[model samples]
Every structure is written in structure tokens, then in C-alpha cells.
Target chain A: MDLTPLFLPQSVAVIGVSSSNDRHPANVIFSKNLLRYPVRTHAVNPKGGVLHGEKVFPSVSAVPEEVDLAVVAVRAEYVGSVLQECIAAGVKSAIVISGGFSESGRDDLQTGLVDLAARHDFPFVGPNCLGLYSPGIIDTFFLPAERMVQPPKGGVAIVSQSGGILVDLLVKFADEGVGISCAISIGNKAIIRERQLLEFLASDSRTGVIVFYVEGFARDEGRDFVRMARDCGKPVIVMKAGKTNEGGRAVSSHTASLAGDYQVFRSVLKQHGVIEARNEYELASYCEALSCYSDKSIEGRIGIVTGSGGHGAMAVDACISKGLSVPGFSESIRQQLQDGFSASIRSIAAVGNPVDLTGSALENDFVSAVETLSITPEIDCILLLLLPYLPGISSDLGASISQVYRRSGKPLVAYVPHVEKYRMLIEGFELNRVPVASSIESAVNMTSVLRRCRPC
Target chain B: MLKKEIQNILDSSREVGWVLEPNAKSLLHMAGLPVPRYGWAENIEEAASMAAEIGYPIAAKVVSPAVVHKTEVQGVSLGIDSQEKLQEFYRKMSILPEFAGILVEEMVEGEELIVGATIDYQFGPTVLFGIGGTAVEVYKDVALRMAPLAPEDMSSMLQELKGGKLLAGYRGKEPIKFSALTEVLLSFSDLLMDIAPFIESIDLNPLLCSAQGCVVADARIILADQ
Candidate 1:
């Protein structure tokens, strides 16, 4: 199916627009595209008045120009007719933002829409979704723009099964200054599925990494998903839910018991080199890390340089649990690190795998340690546990670490606790392209993802 | 092309149940899977002759289409070193209503492993590997992949098992040759792919693996209703 109009429409019509009520979802969507997207916006209302100083046509067929796409935000009872009108008008595709279909015990309504779309031979998104976002081209999210946080434009593309989760993720991306090429919410997935989006995004020049929040897979699409993932030539990360009672609970046979639906799904995803994130934080962190360092090769071996002993131990545990090795530095690398530090700092610091450059350590101590470890042949990646509370440590230390990261060409992830005052210190590392995580565990998780990324 | 034995099995299976022993062994052998030397015996004298030919300390089981679990029905008897013992076991097996004949075969003792294929609702033609023996149901230690599986996939599937160390020669035992195991798994995957339409599932429980090689000790091929 050609998804051009659904994502990159030249012109869009918002059906069921309420001219008088500015807060209606259709009106908000109209206002949002009018102010931002380059595409021309057309509003349709049966009343056929003016909205935002533009004429509101009585229906999509009455629109002046060819409608590339239509956003069906009309009432549930009238959604099928609106889609019929759209089909008649020769609109290429649509996103049905109206709710109350399958999600609200209205299977008849949902089936009607599905049949209508099939008859028209056009692709459409959900009858209960926030719709699609194509960076600067079109965004059909009807939530008020003031309440939404837009992420900077970059390489990650997100496909979600739940709108609320997508919204939360976008806000997190915006807060972290992480950029996304596109974000699509595929609620109910009556027709369009992640597999379709995956095929489209695989060739998309803008998307370097693809992430999905999937509740379940459609009937036989799991195999195709795996095949596509293997051949896509891009990193695919998935967070699949509904495994508790996903499918086939009352099964017979040892194969059925051991290879239950979820277990097979998990194993297949892993076998195809798709990273599976367990939680929202891992999803966000892995996305950030992969987006920034997707081209860099990171082996599972890690070299840790920390300012706190306890945090260092925790980072070691976290990395080891995730199949990442934290090997001790060889004598030559250890000597170079020890020689680079000052005598007083050397007396207090532990120059080993988790090179604990203690609280009394100065800025040069971190710079030298990272520089030494980054050049070490045995080290594949570096984890910097930066504690701003250490009086000798400050935001300037991030630049030195970032410089080594650039020169060394090894992946680096920083962990800074969420101290209110340490915001700039965290940004200091982030602004330099060093992905920072809020906790040690998350940083290690991102490191594991980077290790799994296909080598450039 | 499927062998004549499997073609006949497919032609005759009218309901959803386990295929008979001769059909199962024939299909396994036709797919290039290793199985102990064996032959069907219609009478006690034939059973004793086959046991002697296969060389002593043999295992014998009643071949019945109606009885799916031979051990539960006391249809199986092991360690028959003499002709008298073999004849006695064959006579005991012949009285059962479902008994068609007796299967006389060489005995194989080694670490047990389970391998199987099932048509998953979501992902079709999935192959499985796991720890086996009587504890097959109790432990349920297994890993799965969609067929047809590659060599690396077979190795990783074995690695995923909880008792995976047994394949690597656990407890002073020589490591089972991985090349031989890989061939069995690859052939099993090919067979599942080939007859995917006619079969519901295939279970080769307690596949014996030792320093020498691996063999399908017991097999059950469940046919989908025609």
C-alpha cells in the first residue's frame, strides 16, 4: 500500500470540524497544522462556516483542491459516511482519529470502517488513535500543542500501539533533547500494523533506528516481522506487552509448554537481532544511545571510570547482569592511568576496572582516566559515573570526557542522579553527543544496546 | 519427494492422533534422522530373531495405533538378553486389544534430550530443543525457533536449554559431537517444513546423545485430521 498521503500529504482535510469550539480535537488539529505544517489545511463541517479565517466545506467532496489525506474526526456513528465521502473525493489515504469503534465495544462500527477502506482500496490508520507525525510535514495529534512537547528532529522513528504511551515518550524525548524523525500511534491496528510501518521506515532515509511499543502481533505477521527485521539494515527495538496471557494458555504437549507464544516471540525477536526493552526508561535510553552511536562498534567488554565506590559497584553489577563484561585494566593501562593522576589524588583513588577516582579527585583526573581507558585495546566501551556533588568535580569535566569520546571513537554513556541542581551538568554531557542516563542501571542498559547494534 | 512410508501414513491417518511406530520410525529415517537398528516382528519367533540379529540386551515395545503411551500401558519391556526373555515379553504384549505387532531394537543409553516441531498459530513451523527423559514434562527446559533453522540457530537452541551442559560432556562424559547433532536438527527442521501441511506436531522425546553420536530413541508424529 502507498502510505505517502498518510505520512507526507500535500494537502489535508479535517472532517467534523466545530467552527465555534476551538477546544475540539478536530479544531485543535486544524489549528496545529495551519500554524506549523507546510501542507494546506481544509476543515469540513456540516454547518459549512468559517474556521480560523478559512472556509469550512460541508464535506470532503466539496473541498476546492485534490485532498491528499483526510483526518476523520467526526462522531463514531458518522465515521463510515465521512470515509465514504473521502473515498469518493479521491483522497489517497486517511487517519481516523475518531474514537468509539472497537475500543468502545462498537465492533459493527469498526468493521464497517474496515470494509469501507477495503472497498476503497486505500490504507488508513486507526479509528481510535492520535494519528501520524512526519516531523515538519504533518502532525495529526489533536491534543493541544500547548500541552504537547515536540522533540527535535533526528533519526529515531517510533511506532506505538497506545497513544498515551506515545505522548509520554514524546515528552520524554523532548525533555532529553532527543530528536525523532517520525512518531506513529497505531491504536487498535484494525488495518495498518507495525510490519507495514517497518517496511516503510526501513527505506526511509530519515529513520536510522526504529522503536515499537507493541501490545500484540497480528495473526501471521510475526514471521514477516522477523524476516523484515533481519533484512531492514537498521536497528529495531521492541517493547511487547500482553505476554501474561497473550495466547494459547490451555495447550497440550511439551513443545507447547516450553515454546509458549511469549517465549517464542521473545526468542524470535532476539534471534533476529532486535533489542527488546523491558520498560519505558530502557526504551528511551536505548533509543537515545542507538540514535547517537548507532554507527559505532561497541563490544560487550566495558571499562568503568567512577567517582563513587558504591555507584561503581552498582554499575558493575548492572553491566554484568546484562551480559556485559567489566574486565579489570591490564598492568600497562593501569600504570598509564595511575601516572596521569596527581600524587595526592593517586593516593586516594583506586586505579582498576571501576577506576574509582574518589571524591577528592579533580577534573583532570577524570579526563586522564577516560583518555587512558579509551585508548586501551582491551576496552570496548566506557562508562563515566559523574557525581557533581564531589567538590572537585563540576560541569567542565563533561567537555573533557566528551573530547576523549570524540577522539577515542568508543561509545561512552554517563550516569548522573536526578539532582535538581545538577541539570546543567547532565546537559553538559548530553550536548556533546554523550547520551546521559538518570541512573546507573539505565546507562548500563543503553551500553548493552549499543553493543548489540550492527557494526558500521 | 516424501518416502512411500510417509505417503502411506499420510494417506491412512483419518483422525488427529499419533502415527503408528513403524510409520514414525520410517518417516524419521527418511528425513535423514538417526535411529537405532530395528525391525517389526509379527510373532514371538520373529521378535527373537530380530533381537538376536540386532545383538542382545534389546528393547521391545508393542506397536499399537490406539495406544499412544506405551509405557503407561506396560507395552514396553527392556534388557532382554536371552531369547526366552524376548519371547516372554512378546507373549505378554500380544494379548492387548490394540497390539498390532512387537518392535525389537538395540538398546541405547545416554544423556536424554527432547526435540520437536509444532505449528504455532502465530509463527508457523516452529522447532524445539530441550532437556528430556521422564522429567521432560516436569522441567520443561526448552528453546524454540521458527523453521527452517540454520546451523547457528541449532547450536544456540541447544545453548538455551537449562541442562545444556550435558551436551558438552557433563560429569566426565565425552562431549557429544556437535556436527552430528546439528545434522539431526537441520534434517528435523527440513522434515517439518516439508510435511508442514499434514502434520500437527512431531515429538522425538528422549533423543539419546553420547560421545559416539545422537539417535532418535522414541518418536511420535501426530497427524492433522484429513
Candidate 2:
């Protein structure tokens, strides 16, 4: 199925909009899209009243405009009729934002929605979800626009099982300057799930990396998903919940007992070349790095350049523990790096695997070290642990290093503390396409995950 | 392709619901996997002759549907080096409930390892390789992959094990032929895939490995409940 209509819908009808309550989820979605997004928005309610100065059609078919998608936010019992009206009206797709389905112990109702959608050959996002947010195209999330921070538009597409987690990630992505192309909340997944969305996003021209926040998979669903990811031609990162053996099934063999759900899920993900994020931080770190550098070729070899020797040591330790190599610089490269540095700090600088240009080193020294490392054939990537608090380092160092990064065409990542004062420095690197992490550990994680996902 | 011999063994053991050691070993042997030379005996006279023919220091295991773990029931007697000892094992074990017969097999020793397969709920037919013995549960050092094993998966699974280095000649021990071990795992993978629909799980525990190659020292096949 072509998912273009679901994601890039030009016209949307918001069903269940209430004229009496502007705070209703359906009203919130209608006003958010009509006021901000580019998609043509229509409101639908049984009362046939005015909402936000627009005529509210009594049903979907009453809308005179051609509707590509319908955002259903009615009560659980009314969702079936609302969806039927959408199918009869020939709407291309729907996103059911209502909650009372399988998650509420109403499997029969959820199954009814599935059968209704299947019989009509229709596709929808959820029976209980916040729905999708395709930047500039449409926004179906019921959360009011002013309350949530919108992430900048870019390559990473997130498909999550929990809407709360999706909203949290959006806030995080916005705060971290991690650009996102879309965010989909697939609660209950009564009609569409991760596997289908993964296939869609893999072929999406706008999506460079795909991330999934999975709680569990149905029978054989995970296998089919990972197998598709093996050749999806895009980087797929998954952060799974329910890793513990709290609900393990009774089995009779060592293999079965040892094959805990998480263990098996993790193993399958690794075997199929999917990056498994162990925690939320890794998820964001990986998505941030991969969103920026998935197109670059990155071997596991890293060359660390830091203003503080302690940061360099920590970075080297983190790199080695993650199975990434911090190969020692060749004598000639070290000599060249030293030649580029001023005598004030060159004599005391440590020019080994992780070159430490001490606190006294100026911005020129850091940029020169990064430049030298970027051209070195032995170094597959560079990790710059920038300490903005240092005396000689200027804020323009981010811009200076980014210039070298662009000229050398080598992948570079920066570790800048996420302080308000250093926003300019972080933005300078990020705007020039170099990913910046808030912590040294996240910086190393970004480089390592980028290397692991280089093939896709 | 599944061997007809394995099919017949599975077919005959249908009523029992699980394949016993001797028949499991026969299934492995027929599938071209290396198993210790063995024979089944229903009587003391037959057990004595089979032990003599297979040579001394043989292991005798009880073949009964009701007894899954023979060692726990004191139904396993190792180092039965004499005809009298074999008769004594039969006399003692025959009194146990559901005592069907004795499986007489040549005793072999080497580094212990395990290869197993189970039909996972989601992935279906996953294979495991790791350190094996009575401590298989205690150590819990294993690596798993979806079956119909990939060429690279075999070595990667071995590499993932904590005791993988032990297989490459630990200390003064000679390393077992890796190609031989790979062939056995691949054949076992094929057999598991072929029988996955009918079986719940299978185990080739304590597969003794040395310079001579690998052997299935013990085997267990659990058929799916009807």
C-alpha cells in the first residue's frame, strides 16, 4: 500500500469535534491543524455547530471538500460508525485517536475495528493513540500545540507504541536539536503496527533513520519486522520495554528458559543489523547521531580530540568498552598536528590516540588538531570533547571545527555541555551538519552507534 | 531433507510423546551427525552382548517414557566395565516404574558443550550453542540465533559464548576440528527445521569435543503435545 496518503495527506477531517468544549481532544486536533499545519482541515460533529469560526459538518460525508484523511476522536462505541462514515465518504485513511480498545479489555471492539478496516481496504494509525505528526503536513496529536515543544524537521522518523513516550521523545528531541521528520503514536495498533510502518518509513524519501519504541510483538510479528529491517536500506533503531523475566512462560528446555523475551528480541535485532538501544538516553543519542550521519561511511576507529585530558581519558575508556577502537596516531600525523599547534601549548599537549590540547590551548589549536585528525587515513571518525569553560577556547571554535569538517568530508561529532551559554557553539556545529552531544558518554555513544549503523 | 530413519523413529515414538536417548541418538546418526556408537537392549542377555560388542566402560541409561531425566531417577549407570556390573544395573533399574530397557553405549570423554533448538514464540526455531554439563544451568553461557543457520551465524554464535575460547584448545588441550563441529551444527540445524513443526525442543547436551572431532554424548527430543 502507498502510505503517502496516510503521511502526506493534503486534506484532513477531524471527527468528533465538540462545539461546547474547545479542550476536547477532537477540538484540539482540529484547531491545531487548521491554525498551524498546511493540510486543509475540516471539523465534524453530530451537533452541526460552529467551532473556531468554521462550519462543523454533522458527519464526514457532509464535508464538501475532498478529504484525504480523517482524524477520529469519538467515544469507543461511536468510533465504528465514524470510521464507516469515513470509508463511505471515500476518505483515503484515518487516525483513530479514541482510547477504549484492546488496551481497555475490549478486544472484541478492537477486533471489530480491524474487520471494518479490512473489509473496506482502509488503513488507519490507531484505535487508541495520539496519532501522527508529519511536520508542516499534518498534526493529529491531541495535545495542544503551545504545551509541547515541536522538534525541527529532519530525517529521523519515530514510531512508538506509547503516546506518552512519543511525546516525551518529541520534547527531548526538540531540546537536544535532534531534527525529526515525523512522530507516530501507535497505541493498541489495532490496524497498523511497527512492521508496516517500518516498511513505509524505509521507503519514505524524507526519512533517513527509523526508530521504534516497542513494548512487545504479536506471534511472528517481531521476526517479520527484523527480517524486513535486514534489507530496509535505512538505519533501524529499536528501544524495547519488558526486558525482565517477570512474565516468563513455563518451558521444558534450557534453550527455552534462557530464551527470555528480551534476550531473544535483542539477539534477533542484532542478527538482522538493527541497532538495539538499551535505554532512553541511548535511543536519543543514536537517533541524534544517525539522523545527522547515516549517509557517511564510519568504521569503528575513532580519534578523540579534547581540551581536557580527563575528558579524553574517559572518552577513550568509553570507546574501548563499546568495542570501538581508538587507534594510536601515527608519528607523522602527530608531528603534523604538533606543527599546526602554537608553541604555548604544543609542548605540553598529549598527541596520542586521544590528543589532549590542555586548558591553555587556544581555539586555533583545537581546530588544527581536528583538521589533522580528519585527514588521517587511520582515523575513521573524530570525537571532539569541547570544554567551553576553558579560558583560551572561544565559542567560535564550533564554527571553526565545522569548517574543517566540511572541507575534509570526514564525520565529526562534538561533546558540548548543554548549557544556555554554549547554545551558539552547539548550534554552530549542528547547523553545519556535525552532531553534538550534551555529555562525553553520549558523544562516544553517538560515534559508536553511527559506526554500527554505517552499512544501512 | 529429513532422513526416513529419523521419521520412523519419530513415528514410532509418537505414542510416548517424546523421543528417548537411544532413538534420539539414532535420529542424529541417521541425519549424518556424529553420535557415540550405541544399541538398545530389552533383556539382560541382550544388554550384556551389546556392552561386550561395544567394549568396556559403557554407559547404561533407562529408556522409559515416564522418566525424562534418567540421572535424577538413578536410572543412569556409567563405567559398567564388567558383565556382572551391567546385570546389577539392569537388576536395580528394572524395578523402577516404567522401566522399558537399557541403552548400552560406548563411553567417551572430552570437553563438554551443548547445541540445542527450541521453537520460540515469536522467532520460531532458534538454535543455541554454549558450554554444557550439569553446570549448563549454573553457568548459563550461551548464544542463540534463528535456525536454518546462516553461514556467518555459526562462528558468530561460538564467538559470543563466554567459554568459546575453551573450544579453541584451552591450555594444553588440542583444539577440535572447527569444520567438523560446524558440519554437525549445520546438520542439526537442518534437522531441527525439518522437525520443528512436530517437536517442541531438542538438546544435544555434553557434546564431547576433542582433536578427534565432536560427538553427541547425549541427546533429548521433546515432541510437541498433541
Candidate 3:
């Protein structure tokens, strides 16, 4: 059995809560977020009581509740005794967040924790780590994220070894209005590692796409994780770092990790069906698309609709970069676009595959071109390029895209520059059960990644 | 064949090794190899007179168990045309603290090749044969085959190297009898196959290729006798 209770805890006990400067950083912040979660929380501290208006029990056993997960924030040297109390209290899941374990090359304390964990069959999160936050279960991250973090619900689940990278990715997604099912920061993996997590996530219904940021991988461990994801038939994208020798050595020093032969890692990833991402943004956008539209089939071609000629060219380049074809319209469809577009729109567009809907194009003009493209049995998908700064846009772009989205089984994904204007458009697509995106890269990545993961 | 002879040496006296280079080559010559004619000497007078008796324009080199590659330490002198040069050569070679004795020999001329046999810890005894003049190791154009290899295998191993092109009359050169070189490689292979357990390394470097036949010019055999 997996120690998922460690991450998906219904009742939690925060072991070292305090308002003072010295008590760990995660404790002070998580103490407030825990109040929002529907959980029986036991705040353990002898000196402080009623933190976040919750009673502070001296120890976990005295809390008089079934503690599924225990977050220990005591001193590094005193963590072993805290774990001993957790084991006695029948705490099946424990997240050890304080640093200075085996990662510091201190042998004895690390060994003690490992032995203590094994006898009781408890899984650990980290000795130096930012904890898990599963948005699917409303398990928000403990890092004062409430003020800025708007959790978007979709298919993507991310597991990062670096906590800093995890937070940074979340912020990036928030900036783009892209959401995730779960974001996990598994630092200094004292007990749980990528392999076990991959196997467990294979059975999870909430997670459709799994993205990871890796600096290094141990010989057999990372290979096993890839194979598990492949067998589960989920798209796994990795932003594998350390492509150079010096970068590889740095990866080793950072994680105390053995960076296996890079070619071997590449070979295994290919054989087991994992996609290597180009960067963090693409990695997130790729998984976001996969998780959102895991069932859709992007046959072979795309129709581009843009406000300017430059955006049209950029969209064509994006399609070509993704190895997707921009199949042209039939002669009748081209004439229909010529008839639908005004004189100003007709002068700029050569009426090719990337039909540049020139400036002054209105909501009716957008609707007419899409109606023409979608009705054609020739086109497979539509890449709707919307510039919020453009004129004659119906404040109802969200409703218009949703109508086109449902009328044709072909997917409609958009790229918007104005975040405020497109927020409701994104929500409108979600309401109509049509997949939408915020960035052009995200749109391209999502299409390619989803098409690859759920192939023809 | 040479295989049966080496088998007799290993079976009879496998413990106490014939340790030094000269002693080991004497054992090889006794085992039916055409080793170079040489006389072992102690002092300068004996070495020079031995070189004179063997004839002028001879070679004088130290024979030592401690010294492995003579050229590495400048331990050998070739073409001693006079008694003075021979004595001087003896003075430099014999006085080395590591040197065991001096070998005064008549220098023979023709083509030269190296033949070796090594027992691999994993694949067992292996034989190697290739070009050998002055820079054999530096120009590592060689071929190897598993030991106890057949005569045909030895011929094929020779054909495996680009250096073996010389044995076939390279660039307007007189071919050093192909049959003779093949015989030397096969015999070396037989030697390794027969000795098996007790033998660790064998080197017959500069196996001179003459108009008549191929003869062993110098040899060093290391025995793991313990």
C-alpha cells in the first residue's frame, strides 16, 4: 500500500506551530491555510496555544484524533523523537520538513530516520522540502499562496524535486491562467522517490498529464518511472536539466545524486514513451493540454485565424515547429472567405492556409471565417488567434468560441495577450466543455502533447 | 609441435620459474625456438671480449629481471663496431643498480616483428602478433585472438592488422616469408595454450624476419609461479 495519506490527509497534525521568528517558515504560513481545509488539526506546541484560533496540543497522541498525516517542524536533532511519537500515535503518514538529514552527509541521523520509517511502514516527504498541495483535494500548498495563487482545475499534475522550481512553475501558470490537478515538491526524497510516485499516480483518476523537472536520475530508478507512466498510458513530459558535463556534476552536488549516462537516460525515455520538453513553460503548457483534452483526436491539419498578418505568420511557424500540417482550404472555401472578409481584410490575406484576418476584423467577421473553416470537411483543427487589443471584438469572444467549439467536434484552442480580457473567454470555453489556453506556446504545446499522448 | 613441449615444462616443473630474461629465453630455445646466439658476461673485459669473439658490429644490452622495456630507460646499445664502444656500452649498461648482467650478441639483420601471449583474467590465454621495429607499442597496429587458437586462426589474426600488409611485400619490399611469420604466431599461441595456468605474460619482440625464415631476436617471459 502506498502512503498517499501523507499527501492526501483528511485529518492533519502540525507538530511545531509558533508565531515567533525561529519556528520554521512553513509552520507560520501553513497554520493559516490549514484553517481553510476541512481537517481536524492538532497544533502541537507546549508554549503556544490557539494558533489560527485552533487548540494547540502538547503532542500528537494527546490530540484525541485520528492523525492521517503529521507535519513535523521541530529542530533537526529533535525530529527523531517527534517521529517516535508519531509512530506511537499510529500516524501512517509523516512529512519531515526540517533540513539537515542525510543530504547534509550526516550519516547517523539519516540512518535513524530510515530505520524508524521502515519498521512502521510510513512514507516520508522530505527532510529539506516544500510539502505537497493537491488542488484536486483542495490541499493547498503551505507557502502563503492564498493572496496570489488562483488554482485552475484541469488534468495536469507536476512533481518536482526542487521546491523552488515548483513554486516558480505555479506562479508562471497563474500568470497565464493555466491550472493543475496537483503540484508536489519532493525535496531530498528521504523516503518517497519518483519511481514510487509514478506508480501511484498511474492509478490516480484526477491526474491526466504528469510533468517533472529533473537535474539527474539514478540508473534504474528513473527508467522505472518512465516505464510506469508509459504502461499507464499517460503523457509524461520532463524538463531534464544538466545536458553538459559541468551541469551534470552540478546536478550531483545539488541532490547528492548520481547522474547516470545521459545517452542511456535518453534511450530509456524514448523506449518507454516519455517526451523531453524544451523548457519549463512548454512543459507546463504541454501537460495542461494533455490533461484537459485527453480524449480529443487532432487528425492531421490546422486552420489559423489571426487579427494581424504578423500573428498569422507566427501561428504558421508555431504549427510547423510542432510538426503539424497547415492544410489549405478548398477553392470554394477560399472564395467564401473572400466574400466574408471586407475589402481591407481581403487585400492583406492571400487566402492561403494561414488566412490573415487583417485589422478592423469584427466579431461577425471572426464568426464567418470560423463558420466557413469548420463547415469544410477538409480541415481538422482550428487555432483561433485572438488579440484582445484588436477592434470590433464582441466582448462575447468567450461565448462565440464556445459556440464554434461545440458546433464542430474539431478542437478550438486560443492564444490571448490581454490576460484580463481573455479570463472570461477561458472560463466560457471551460463552461461549454471546450479546452482553452492563455499563451501561444501553451496552445501549440497542448495540441502536440495531447495528440502525441492520445495518438491516432 | 611447440605446444607439446611447453606442456611438458608446465607439467614437470610448474613451481620454480626460470625468472630472468636470458634464463627464460634459454628455456625457450630449449623448447625449440631459433633464439639469437648470445653470451652472458659479468665484467667489462668479459663483455667486450665476448662481443669481439661473437664478431664486431654486434649488439650489447643488459639482461635484467627488474628491467622490462630496455628502450624506456636507455638500457641498450646497438651496432658496437669496436672494442672501445663495446666496453663503453658495457660500462653504462652493467653499472646500472637495477641491471643483472650484460648480454653480448651478434646483431642479425632482416625484418622485425613482435609476437606476444597474454592470459586474460576473463577470456583466458590470448595471443597477439604485429609489426615490431623501434616503435611497436607506439604504433599499436596489432591483432589478437583467443589462445589454444588453431594454425588457421593465427594466419587470419595476422591478416587482421594493417601492419600485416608489410609481411605481404609492402611498397616494393621483399616479403618476409609469410609461412615463417605464421609459424611464429601459431607457435606463440601454442606456447600460451600449453602453459595455461602458470604463465602470465610472454613477449618475443623483434622476432627477426630473415631471407631464410623468422627467428626469435629477443624474448621475455613472466611466470606467475606462486
Candidate 4:
């Protein structure tokens, strides 16, 4: 199915908009799209009325212009009729935002929606979901615009099973400056599931890295999903829940018992080229890094440059624990890095793999070390542990180091404490397409995840 | 084709939910996996002669649908080096309910490992590799991949196991030829694909590996419920 209209619809109709209650999910979606997004938004209600100064049509058929997408947020009993109206009105696709489907023991009602959609050859997002959010194109989430923080628009695309998780990630991504191409919450997944979304986003022009927050997959769904990911030609990162035995069903053999849901899910992901994130933090770190450096591959050789020796040691430990090598600089590379250092801190600097240009080092010293390591043939990637509080380090340090990153195409990530004072430094690296993490471990995780996505 | 042959075996063994070890071993052998030289014996005389032909220091297991776990039922006796021991094993095993016969096979020992396939709910046929023995349950060191596997998939499965180093040799021991092990794994994968429709799960535990080659020490196949 072509998912273009579902994601990049030019016109949208919001069904079940309420004139009395402004807090209604349908109204929230209607007003958000009408006021903020560029998509022409039309409101629909059984009783014709006015909402936010726009005429609310009695039904989708009464809409003046052609409706490309329908956002249905009516009661479970009324969802089928609304979907039928949408299909009859020639609406290309729909996003069913109402709950009380299979999740609330209304499998029959959910099945009815599926049959109606299939009979009409129509496509829809969910019967129990928060719907999708495509920046500048559409936002079907019920959360009011003011209540949520929309991340800057860029390459990452997130498809999640839980609306709650999707909203939380949007806020986190915004806070971390991780730009997103789109965010989809596929609640219940009665119609569109992760596999279909994966197929769509794998070819999406705006999407460079795809992340999935999956709870579980139905029979044979996971197998198909991984096979698609194996040839998707982009980094597909997944964070699966239910990793323990609590979710396992009764089984007969030692293999069955041992092959718990999470174990098999994890193994197949590795067998394919999909990257598995252990936690929410890893998910965000991986998405942020992969989206920024999608074209770069980490071959497990990491070179670290830190202002503090302690941070370097921690990065080394993190690298080594993840099976990444932090090889010592060769004699010539070591001499070259030392030669580029400023005279004031040249003697005090530790010109090794995790080249520590001590507290007295200037901004130029850090840039020089990064530049030297970035050009070094032995280093696959560079980890910059920037301590902005150093006496000689200036605010332009991020921009200065980004220049070196831009000149040499080697992938670089930085660890900057997420303090307001260092926002510019972080932005400087990020704006230049280099990822910055709040913690040293997160930066190391980014490099490790990149290593997993090595091109075959 | 092996699929038709495997289906015939499943069709004939409809009464036994778990295919007997002798049949499971034959299935593996027919699929080109290495198994110790063996024969089925209906009595003490046959057991003794088969042990002599296959070489002594052999293992004898009860071939009965009533005993799914032979060791747990005390229906297995290893190191039956002489005629007295073979006769003793036959007498002990023949007393068990629904006793079919005795499966006498040459004993082989090396680093014990397990290779199994189970019908996963989501991934369907999934192959499992791990450290095996009686302690398989206790240690629980295992890795899995959806079958039929690619060559790279087989190698990665080995790398994922915590005890995978044992197969590569450890502490001055000669490493088992990875090609030999991978061949067994590949054949097992092909067999799994052929019989997946007829079976729910299969276990080849204690698949002994040495510098020489890998061999299936024990086999079990559980047919899917009708």
C-alpha cells in the first residue's frame, strides 16, 4: 500500500470534533492541525457547528474540499460508520484515535473495522492509537500543542506501539535536540503494524534511521519484520519490552523454555542487521547518533580525546566492555598530535589514544587533537570528551572542533554535560551534523551502535 | 525427498507424541548429520551383538514411547563394555512399561553442546545452540537464530553463546574444526526446515565435539499435536 497520503496528506478531515468540549481529543487534533500545520484541516461532527471559527461539517461527505486523510476519534461503536463515511468520501487513509477496541476486549468491534477497510481496499493507522505526527505535514496526536515539545525536523523516524511511549520520546528527543522526520504511535495495531511502517519508512526520503519501540509481535510478524530490516538499506534500531520470563508461554522442551520471547527476538535481530537497544537511554542515544552520522560506519576502532583523564578512563572502560578497541596511537601519529598542541600545555598533555589535553589546554589544543585523530587512518571514529569549564577552553570549542569533523569525514561524537551554559557548544557540534551526548557512556554507546551497523 | 520420508515417519509414529530416539537419530543420519554407529536390538542377544559390532564402551537407551526422558527413568546405561553389562542393561530396560527394544550405540565423548529447534510463536522455526549436559537447565547459556540459517548466521550463533569458547578450543586443547561443526549445524537446519511442519520441537543434546568432528550423542523429536 502506498503510505504517502497517510504521512504526507495535503488535506485532512477530523471526525467527531465536539463544539461543547474544547478538550475533546478530536477537537485537539482539529485545532492543532488547522492552526499549526500546513495541511488544510476540516472539522466534522454529526451536528454542524463552528469550532475555532471554522465550519464543522455534519459529516465527511459534506466536506467542501477533497479529504486526503481522516482522523477518527469517535466512540468505538461509531468508528466503523466514520471509517465507512471516510471511504465513501474518497478519503485516501484514516487514523483511528479512539480506544476500546481489542485492548478493551472489543475484538469483534476491531475486527469489523478491519473487514470494512479490507473490503474497500482502504488503509488506516489504528483503532486505538494516538495517530501519527509528521512535522510541517501533520500532527494527529491528541496532546495539545502547548503541552508537548516538538523536536526540530530532521532524519530520525520513530514508530511505537504505545502512544504514551511515543509522546515521552518526542519530549526527550526535543530536549536532547534529536530531530525527527516523523513519529507514529500504532496503538493496538489492528490495521497498520510495525512491519508495514518499517517498509514505508525504509524508503522515506526524509528518514535516515528508523527506531521502533515494540512490545511484541504476533505470529510470524517478527520474522517478516526482521527480514525486511535486513535489506531495508537503513539503520533499524528496536527497543523491545517484555525481556523476562513473565511473558513466555508454557513450552515443552529445553530449547522452547530457553528460547524466551526476548532471547529469540534479540538473536534474530543480531542475525539480521538490526541494532537492539537495551534501554530507553540507549534507544535515544542510538537514534540521535545514527540519524546524524547515517553514512558513517564504525569498525570498532574508537579514538578518544578528553580534557579530563578520569573521563578518558571511563570512556576506555565503556569502549572495552562493548568489545570496541581503543588502540594506542602509533609513534608517528603520537608525535604529530603532540606537535600540533599549543606550547602552554604541550608538555602536560597525554598524547595517547584518549589524548588528554589537560585542564590548562586551550580550545585550539582540543581542536588540534580532534583534527589529528580524525585524519588518522587507524581510527574509525572519534569520541570527544569536552569539559567546557576548563580555564583555557572557550565557548567556540564546539564550533572549532566541528570544523575538524567537517574537513575529515570520520564520524565524531562529543560528551558535553547538558547544562544551559554549554548549550551553544552542543548546538555547534549538532548543527554541523555531529552528535553530542550528555554523558560519556552515552557517547560511547553511540559509537558502539554505529559499529553494529557496519556496512556488509 | 527428505520431507516425504520425514512425513512418513511422523505418520507412522502418530501414537507417540515424542518420536523415539532411534527414529530421531535415523532422521538426523539420513539428513547427513554425523551419528555414532548403532543399531536397534529387540533382545539381550541382539544388544550384545550390536555392541560388539559397533565396538564396546557403548551406550544403551530404552526405545519406548512411555519414557520421554530415558536418563530420568533410569532406562539409560552407558559404558556397556562387556556382554554382561549389555545383558544387564537389556534386563533393566525391558522391565519398563511399553518397552519397545534397546538402542545400542557406540559411546563418544568431547565438549558437550546442544543444538535444538523449537517452533517459536513469532519467529516460527528457531534454532538454539548452547552448552549442554544435565546442567543445561542450570547454566542456561544459549543462543538462538531463526532457521534455515545462512552460513554467517550459523557462525554468529556460535559467537553469541557464553560458552562458545569451548568449541574454539581452550587451555591448550585443540579447537574443533569450525567447518565440521558448521556442517552439522547446516544439516540440522535443513532437517529442521524439512520436518518443521510435522514437529513442534527437536533436541540434539550433548552433541559431542572434538578435534576430529562433531556427533549427535542423543536425539529427541516432539511431533506437533494433532
DockQ of each: 0.60, 0.68, 0.02, 0.78
What is candidate 4's lDDT per residue for B1-226, written digit by digit as tens?
A: 5666767777887788888888888778878999999899997888888888898889989999888888898888888788988898788888899999999998997889999999887888999988998789899998889998888886677777788887787889999877888998988898888878778888899899899889999988888888
Candidate 2's residue-wise lDDT over B27-130, tens digit each? Answer: 88888899988889999999999998999999998888888877788888888889999999988888888888999999988888998888877888888888
Top candidate (DockQ): 4
Candidate 4 per-residue lDDT, tens place, A19-97, comes to: 8999999999999999999999999999998888899899999998888899999999999988988988899999999
Give the DockQ-based CAPRI class for model 4.
medium
lDDT of 3 at B75: 71
| Per-residue accuracy of model 1 over A267-298 as CA lDDT, tens digit each | 88888888898888888889889888978767
Query: Model 1 reaches what TM-score against the true structure?
Result: 0.94
Model 4, position A261, has a per-residue lDDT of 77
Return the DockQ of model 1.
Answer: 0.60
For every model shown, what is its TM-score relative to the native structure?
A: 0.94, 0.97, 0.63, 0.97
TM-score of chain A of each: 0.95, 0.98, 0.87, 0.98
Error of 1 at A238 (Å): 0.8
lDDT score at residue A284, model 3, on the 0-100 scale: 59
Per-residue lDDT of candidate 3, residues A370-421 (tens digit): 7788777777777778776777785577678768768776766767664665
Q: Which stretches of candidate 2 lie over 4 Å from their true place?
A: B1-5, B11-14
Clashing pairs in 3: none
